[model samples]
Target: MSTSSPSNAISGASSSPSSEDVETIRKNRVLSSKLYFDISDTMVPLIYSSSYDIAFFGLEKLHPFDSSKWGRICQFLIKDGILQQSQIVEPLEASNDDLLVVIKSIFRTLCQKLNLLPKRKTYFGNLNSSSNVSKIIEVPPIALLPHWLVRQKVLYPFRKQRGWAINVGGGFHHCCADKGGGFCVYADISLCITFAFMRLDISRVMIIDLDAHQGNGHEMDFGKDRRVYTLDMYNPDIYPFDFKARAYIDQSVKVKSATSTNVYLKKLDKALEVAGICFKPELIVYNAGTDILDGDPLGELKVSPDGVASRDEKVFRFAKEKNIPLVMLTSGGYMKSSAKVIADSLTNLSNKGLIDLATPPLGTFLCVHM
Candidate 1:
């Protein structure tokens, strides 16, 4: 998330304001600017909390999923530290699915409680009995950047290189098609890739996923779409273990994160070297999730901030060197507040006059800049 204080424009001097007046105005402006960042990193816990489970709490106010499901899911989610205990929505009754129906009703009542009715309505409108179950929709077609645009001219290429990156999910890389070869409404990395490709069609598009998990989602989605390429850097025994897209996998820079940063960085460096040789992509979608952070509640590997920064800097610097447009999305990380902080670091890169918002990712990262 990104936010900035309003510019202290010195308009036609009302006889130049006193120094004290200018100082006072600056202080007020600093205090009033709103805070923005990837709120999902913060709001996810609130959405999963027990307080959110109350029929009355969400009734007319929030999503209308079966209340029972919320309890069932949140228990596992919270117990695993995917969410915080303090974040639970409260004042809910104890019962099974029947009470859940009431909870759904409560969602209608709670719309005003959360101040999200309009956004929900707009979100729902996009649904026509079709949408990803995860609700990660494809970037809209109208907003799609096609090859025509990139070919016509070059605008701030530096913005593409050093700008903030927003890498979404890569571990469960399920594409928009099912394993049985049927259509799945939600798995649309292809949609994202297509949009990027159409816009930067003249340039190679790189999907560099470093989730200790796999990119099964993208593999299925873009396996046949040659315009897109993948470098699945992960372990094979990890969750979502059925990943089989390695046949076409351009750079499978896999490694085990031993109890040493040196080993981890070595693996990451190998991945980068491979990526440089195979694709030299003009755009990169980096999934810099910190589940790899040492002692991560969910991840099996061990990685530290120093290691992560090394990995991040390599990508950012490489992209800068190649002048590649990058769109980094958060894929996954179970640690508390790790994703948001990682996002904040990336946003800082944006403020350095390197990143430009082609389209802001789902977070507060661009509100200040926008």
Candidate 2:
């Protein structure tokens, strides 16, 4: 966050703008943007794209975070007959101004200077070069940064439709308005909620971040914002130990390392109950991360594959019971097996009648192994 004022032209955001002026700019940018478009009822709210999968010449396999997990999850769903390629909605590539609708003006210029958002070269350059893999991995794949693009695709026609969507990628809760960390280069979660607030004519939103790492990014962005209610359930001792952001959490539930599945679910049930009493949100954003699975090195918790499915079902059920519009993002989870687990959870949700989209045949049960 630079010290520059609103008058500075994409130079910096060091100074704050008057609330009324800022809102006006945000609204204007959003209204003029081409990212938001109308979709027919025939297309499924499940958002994904083949470009989301990045093959770094086998370099991605070296990184703990499975970069291709987004495409893999969709592949499994398509293979199991839960979804067809034609039914899924492919999002438009988000442009510079599209991101500026939520982020500060300076970020776009900074990204350009760093060659991070290259115009001449590929959006994502070759990672085979020295230190390139580490550099590219630091910024999440381009697929994960399309939060605003997907939000409009889902929320624009929300009133006439199911009002729920699942972006096979995103939930970059570790990135905020000013900074990016934990492999998150842009604050897509913040951008999505901000766009929803500006364009959807909605005021209240609830973020249910179940990632193993604390969602310090959004917590920081919405710390004092009463309009947003955050319910983050993450491990205490994890990558980000931001005590300041932790204080802002409306509902903070901590599960220690090696915490069993049953105990974790019980806490979530109680948390959701309390949240229902505290705030009635117009929209819910669920960040379903599988990093908490038993064997993950980063998220030291002990949840199983089955437990992950149960966790997702509980969140979907909570939303269904309230009839609130919900959006789910695959936030984190490094291992190769994370994709399979996510696919299984989708099957569970569909079987439970949570989502109206495609499901397995009556007598057939589908389980995908990566």
Candidate 3:
């Protein structure tokens, strides 16, 4: 058995638990966890680490997904003089205890597959079953590696960049607490929110999921919870045609395939307006996926590079106007240009004064100046 705390994972886990007990365990775990740590004054909330990139013996080439896109995004920011390498914060890995609270049942399943045999663990140190690994990433070759390596190389970066940080990777909205799929192995969004609720004195949260596909993972996890409100804009004709999850969304905006940038932005403005009136959240989680860009095989939308930048600016402005802390996750986008598109968007956010890499002057408005 793994050395991680399996008992805490099960406490108050059943369908019928007293609210007090649930709250206590959740708070206790959040308090004890190391994922939430203090950052130095010099570093910005933009979190990225070289470890975020996954590669081994050239196996990464098998998948169409750009595995090195995360690193490339940071590189572009540096090249453009918008971000400094020293200002980026490196996050601590989310230990098993930290993940168990949000992904209780699924945590056990992943561990079983990942820690298959004791001897394998000694040899590979982080071996996981290839069958299970292939399901989340959709890359067949990744399963051949040891599970420990996958966690260290792929999942750990996601765990580290959870709250108030723009993670270069993660936004696995397809995987839920009980299952994992659609290139998502862990419920990082759910985990981040849960930690915030327990540790950060935050109660209400808004999820602005602008990925091409519906964010079914977070939808499934937070659907019943009243504290979270989801604004999902996706192509209804694409993968994961989940009608059940759609019911859970607070505001659902469907943009058809090949939708122009103008049309997409117009609909987003309306959606954000409606969301503003419908709910007031303490924090905003922006799932900024670039798959909607033109020529993307999966997203099928035709949004240009400038459109993506505008979209991010709008969301940031929304949060800044409300003065709510925002956490952005670069979710799904498969094309090679996806990294450049994302980098340009971040640069746009900085240029528009929506987000600050360096410390800003007091009383400075985060919204765009008229």
* TM-score for each of the candidates: 0.49, 0.78, 0.85
- Model 1, residue 338: distance off in Å is 1.1
| Worst ten in a row by lDDT for model 3 | 361-370
CA-lDDT, candidates in order: 0.44, 0.71, 0.76
The candidate, 1 or 2, that scores higher on lDDT is 2
Better of 2 and 3 by TM-score: 3
lDDT of 1 by residue, 1-370 (tens): 0112222323333333344433344333323332112333233212222232223222212222122233444444444444455533222121212111112122332332234343343222232222221232222221233423321211111011111243222222443333211111223244344334433343467888776666676676566656667877776656556556766667776666454567877877777877788776666767665666676654567777657656667777777878886655444455544544454444444454354322223443321100
Which residue runs does candidate 2 get wrong by more than 4 Å? Answer: 1-19, 104-136, 139-164, 359-370
The sequence of per-residue lDDT tens digits that candidate 3 reaches over residues 96-130 is 66666775443334335344322323111222566
Better structure of 1 and 3 per lDDT? 3
Clash counts for all predictions: 49, 3, 8
Model 2 residue 112 lDDT? 51
Q: Which stretches of candidate 1 lie over 4 Å from their true place?
A: 1-172, 178-185, 199-203, 257-259, 340-344, 347-370
Alpha carbon RMSD to native, model 3: 6.3
TM-score of 3: 0.85
